[model samples]
Target: MLRYTLMRLGIFAGCLVVVWGAVYSGIFPRGFGASNGLWVLLLALVLSAPISWVVLRKERDRASVQIVTKVDRMKANLDANRSQEDVADDSARTQGQPS
Candidate 1:
């Protein structure tokens, strides 16, 4: 997951550089005055999204599988713990009852 996130960040940074270059060289129009930086960031995000989607499909899928496996393991552990606790509680209740 960390690896996938870093790869996505790298793609976004690359797109940001390309977008900045285009705007700087006047090939791409900049936003009004103070909004120029926001414009570049937004364009970078838009461009990076598709590039990352195409480039990172495998990594994304692997991360997703990892997450699902982790969640399943946690759920199994929780169910086991609950069952153990219930058994302990039942034993304690029976021990306290009259003969």
Candidate 2:
């Protein structure tokens, strides 16, 4: 997960830099003034999404599998603990009753 997150952030930063350079270099029309910054941000977001989706598919899948495995292990541990407690309770109740 950490790796995937870092990669995604890196991709976003790269896209932002590219967009910023393009806008500043006059490749894109510059008459929007304050809105030029907004345009750059929007362009970066749009460009980054598809790139990340294509480039990070494997990392995303690995992270998802890890999460699912961790959840399953925790659930098994909880079930085992509950079963032990139930057995202990039953034994204690039986001992208290007259033979």
Cα lDDT for residue 48, model 2? 98
Q: Which residue pairs collide in model 1, if any?
A: none
Residues 1-99 of candidate 1: C-alpha lDDT, one tens digit per residue: 999999999999999999999999999998997999999999999999999999999999999999999999999999999999999999999999999
In order of listing, the candidates' clash counts read 0, 0
* Candidate 2 C-alpha lDDT tens digits along 14-97: 999998998899886664767987898888899999999999999999999999999999999999999999999999999999
TM-score of 2: 0.83
lDDT of 2 at 25: 96
Estimated TM-score for each candidate: 0.97, 0.83
- Model 1: which ten-residue window has the lowest total lDDT? 24-33
lDDT at 95, model 2: 98
